[model samples]
Target: MELQKGAFYLIEDIDPEKIFTAEDFSDEQRMIESMVADFTQNEIIPNLEEIDHQKEGLSRSLLAKAGELGLLSADVPEEYEGGEMGKISSAIITENISAGGSFSVSFSAHTGIGSLPIVLFGTEEQKKRYLPDLATGRKIAAYALTEPMAGSDALAAKTKAVLTEDGKYYVLNGEKIFITNASFADVFVVYAKIDGEKFTAFIVDRDTPGFSIGPEEKKLGIKGSSTCSLIFEDAKVPVENLLGEIGKGHVIAFNILNIGRYKLGLGSVGLSKSAISYATKYALERQQFGIPIAKFGMIQNKLAQMAAKTYASESLIYRLVGNIEEALHGKVDGREIGAAIEEYAVECSISKVHCSESLAYVTDEAVQIYGGYGYTQEFPAERMYRDARINRIFEGTNEVNRLIIPATLLRLGMKGQLPLLQAAQDLAGQLISLQVKTSSGGEVPLEVEFDMLNRAKKLFLLIGGTAAQKYMKKLAKEQEIIEIMANMCIEIYAMESALLRAKKALAKDAASAETKIELAMAYIYDAFPKLENWAKQAIAYMFESNEEVRTNLSIAKRLSKYQPINIIDIRQKIAKKVLEAGKYVV
Candidate 1:
């Protein structure tokens, strides 16, 4: 059951039987999920306003309660007074807790970037000292990485940590802006350059003299989460507190970021589901022209799209989690887990980009469904809209993640891990012969959709492979083309995940799984034209010679073309399901 390190597999290597879908949850998982749901409704929702206002001691109190309930320890080792639950269990906890509005951001940062650096990089002594308190929520955690000067170019941080002549302590001096949980965190995973050149990570306690928290920053949303600047003026951190190897902090930083990215995706899905529920309930209760707004076709469109997007997000997030868990199976060492995560860097970026964008889309539609009231501070839709905006920006901006997707794909291609070049050559041969290869999934439903998905993958290869050959080591400068390739990959992954889940559902109950099928179909149909448009843009950028443009355009048209579905009817059916359940059904 353990995955071998240094082994990479292509999509063809994946077994359909082993692919985990949302419905694969065990009763035990469901119980934990229900516990989180109850806690969110009873504990978090009631205290929303207080949390939003940054009430003194309130977030910590709630976090302590979460710790008491063992909510904060899912990923920690059992020996560290933790749950030692697998990735799936931890992911479910994160997804359920995301319904808590701004509080979820605080929770995510604390568990993810805040504590994971230690969990995945700390020495035995460090873990023994910090993991127990963090697992029990006796001490709050925060991540300090973003500096005033170092935003996207994280390595350009001006913060410096110099070891004393005796080498017993590192005298750190720097300021980190936008440190989540800054106002209340008792411990920080601080990143700085050692001796002014080597990037490193240090565990700095809040009570350390000369370490101070600046005033909280006002924000667009997620106001309940503490955000402040961390000022370190010659703060002395014990040399033993350095995490991982010196000059290898990027190992801890990047791997922990991958964890944050995927978890952010899951949390986005949770928020999307919550937004759909809020919008649907509002639509059902609010009347327009003496009838519930849910009866209106226009309103139905938004509701259906929101539900479909949420379904897609949920499917992909869970599927990705399953992969990560399988990859890390039987591996408990911090470095091993980090390497396993780093192996799926491309998939992590895809999930982060797709799910966050999906949430943004759903929340926007949720606001639109609420009409004028949605624009006001009094409505939940407005808050959801504002809160959802940050997902696309944080954990790495979607733009940065988009770039990472294609870059990672190309890197994998160069390493012979993805068969990208071979696939592209095959695709080109087929295109020249006018022979189209369709997906073959025996006895599977939605064969046409799956076939289209196959073609989409080919289109991604055709465009991406051509771009790579044409640019030839200079493609990094072609940001737009990279973005297009990334978009194709994102859509391909989303469509695949949704299709696989729907196929699984159909196998279990063909008639009852209608909604799942519709959602999958809707996502594919919606993505087709967008993918084509992206292709057109990429093609335009790739070639200036008329013959080259014409030839590629023809190939793009053929690969991107698909028969459109009666999406309006599907939406009506889907919206009916949402309206009936008063939430996202899938």
Candidate 2:
């Protein structure tokens, strides 16, 4: 695949900062997260083998235990016997519980995509009848949206839902594949075609005639979570079972997937951190040639990169979560939730792509760090590596997510956010000031750096502007590349934004002088070289054949005045803090 200059440039300028301090979490949120983590460590970890090996179904006893702790109720409303913790807190709980192997998939599905539809779109009677039981894990909920013919093209569902002549019920006939909780679900939110033209969602009970599950398919990972196909052979569903307005199933499906994407990212972040910790611990203890493997330069480089990427993922996910919270501060009704969530499609998609891909990189390196043992089932890295692979594929594949990010941004651009253009201007100004301060060095031509940065900025603006104009109306069709670019830009912007915030915080805090100084130095030391390289590469690729642009790349490379510090040492300091905190802190 050809590199998109705009996307590559965005990836190049990532800066490190303490944007996500632990202070952002509420005491209750932290407490719940701790409770979930403890539950996973104490209750679930010891029984992973049983859950993984049990063929009859999920361990009923374990599900009951989780329900007792209220782990299954975070997303449901309090009136329905749920915690009503909102997405951020629910995400924290999901992420922490993910440490319990395949059971996390079961837990997240029960709380998120499976039950969110009823809470958001079901009628009052529907909520009363189902939420209480679903929340308490007395019943399991499943969402059936993807069919054999409609995986990525989900709206093209062929399943039929025909209304009875007297309008008493709908006769549903469809098969949904790869449902997470299908084998054990008591209630299912199923979507099917209506009158050959419209799609609608229905809540079908497991006891309904013709509602049956296919044999569980052996899967690549998440073995403990039941995976099967749901078959509805002329299943009779009451009119009251319709999730929302007829033909509005698309709204529920898409919006729920958006939330699912964010939750998936959050879970991936936790797993990535776990992978890093396992690798680092192994590196510190395992010796080669009479010394610890971590003492080797290449091994240290891998560790540093994993830590840096994990930090970046941590910073981005929490920031996105905060944005969502701010967007939905006073809104409580389900009608308002859709619009509120639609506001964050871009950020949610970016977070999904960033965290998932980061975990892929981190986990792969973790296995490498463990050498041969990492590839064995005896070690956790092997399982983590396998489980981590699904994040990028499911929950709207990363390829699909790439499209959503940029397309949403472009659509927003037409509405005047125009993030790429604004960000480019800000970056150009920063480059100009950096140039002016270093003009006296004469080591590299300042004019060349200015020319390269400006050209690269212009190219980014041009591509973004073109996409916005062309796909302003058909946002979904062109969402893939648009998402890829948007994700890249958000990461770059976030890194720079965090650096600025950290710089200001350091300047104001007198008591944190020593710590602040190290953070500030680390940001500059790590960010500048990468930013310069990114600008140069972006410019070179955009105008490679143009002599004027091609000739300026050498000048951009030589402009850096600061010497390269040992990034390994800097990252070790960061990793130590992360380890001590038992999570990414700052």
Candidate 3:
């Protein structure tokens, strides 16, 4: 699973090693997945409207019940009375709960963003004080970093904190907007500039003096989750509550979000899976011209497209999890864990942007499949459509994440963390001559896709090198090229991930891997051309001469050349499987 250390991202060696996938889950993990799915479907789905209305404080009660079941403690250390399950199990919990709608949003905030700060950055005293209660659902937790003056620019927050004269407390004064779980959370991980200079984090209690939550906000989605503003006027926080270190709040704030972004991808995939289920069931039952709509080729095409995209998204997410877990090597300490996860921050952002966009596409098609009912609130497709829109905005906007992908890689190159520039230079000489690893997977499937994927990497390097050379120090400011290169990087990761999973399925001797193979082929068929077009755009932007543009496009055309797979036939196979199961089978 050595997927080219850090931001180099499988650019060089084609190591189709034994990567992790959903099929690789242990028996315990499968049971946990089953248990979570049961809880979400039986308890949360049936009571969704009541929960959506926040009736009788039902959302809070349900969260507490989840805590009692130890679902909320997957990432917490065992010393604090937590389940201490690893990343795979936590991903299962995150993925399975997504169909519960806004309750999943609330659940994710509490378990992931809210409580994880303490688990990952808090000191010994802080963990002992907060983890037990949070782990047991005896208390709720929230994270507040977004301020009115700052949205994406989080480090520029206007919130201020001044040390008390007695040195016992820090007085906080400012406002934080869009605070999730604000209405019921007992603890908050808040960030403020110390003495209006040093940015820092503090664990502020709900009972702190002058600490108040504003009225609930009206939002388009995730309505069941409480979103509000935090007003702090001379609010007193104990000095012991200081998280991480002074002037290093970015370490905690930014690093925690790395985990959040990956989890967002996992949740998006889960919700996409749900959308498939909803659409498949509807297509099967709904009749048109006295026949099931599932019989229509158009509807089947949509279902197949949805399943293939989701397969790619799911593949990339679990592949990322395997890499991160291997990097951590089972460490539970605070800084060590944060730093390890931080190492793969680029991959996480890729997961965030790609999967969220995939969810948006999946949900939209789901609504279209439902015809008139999808627009009305009477069907789940409408709610799913509304809910899916927010993921592209969460964990940082897709635009921001896209910029981060290339920018981070460039930074790593400058710092000599990864030999990105060197690889680009070396690849330039070998672009056309670079041979695909036919013997790589050892008599396995997707050999054609394997070649396309290898060529895709070279194509990315050629354009990336051109962009870097042309823009030089000003590459980050070249937002358009930056985003184009980022999308290329994302597609490269996605193509490899799906290919690896298909190989893994056959490697594991699955009873049936036809659909997995078809999914990989179908996705690669669609993604490779998009990669070439993106490369052509970047080339045209970088070079003004038409000859240079033509030359580059010619190179890309050769690199992207492949016998197009029969996507319609493959999609029909995928749709047959999905419609028969009435869910995302592969």
Q: Which candidate is the best by TM-score?
A: 3
TM-score of each: 0.96, 0.83, 0.97
What TM-score does candidate 3 get on C-alpha atoms?
0.97
Candidate 3 has its poorest 10 consecutive residues by lDDT at: 435-444
What does the lDDT read for residue 399 in candidate 3?
A: 95
Q: On residues 1-586, what C-alpha lDDT tens digit does candidate 3 reach at each position?
A: 5544666655654455557788788999999999999999888999888777777678889998898899989988899989988889999999999999999988999999899999988999999999999998889899999988789888889999999999999999999999889999999999999988899999999999999999999888887788999999999999999999999898888888999999999999999999999999999999999999999999999999899899999999998898887888767676787788889999999999989999999999999999999999889999999889999988789999998998888888888888777878987678657554434333556777788888888888888888888888898889999999999999999988898888777766656667888888888888888987888788888889899989889888878777765789999998999999999988
Per-residue error at 288 for model 2, in Å? 1.6
lDDT of 1 by residue, 1-586 (tens): 3342221223343434566877888999999999999999999999988989989998889999999999999989989999887899899999999999889999999988999898888999999999999999999899999998788678888899999999899999999999999999999999999989999999999988889999988999999999999999999999999999999888888898889999999999999999999999999999988999989999999988888887888887888888889988888687788878988888788889899999999989888988999999898888888899999888789999988887787787898866777777777677765544344343556887876877777788788889888896898888988888888888888888888889878878888778899998887788878988888888887789989999989988888777666899999999999899998996
Which regions of candidate 2 deviate over 4 angstroms? 1-21, 55-57, 416-459, 466-484, 493-566, 575-586
Better of 1 and 2 by TM-score: 1
Writing each residue's lDDT as its tens digit, candidate 2 over 125-179 gives 9999999998888998888888898887788888999899999888988889999
Candidate number achieving the greatest lDDT relative to the actual structure: 3
The number of clashing residue pairs in model 3 is 0
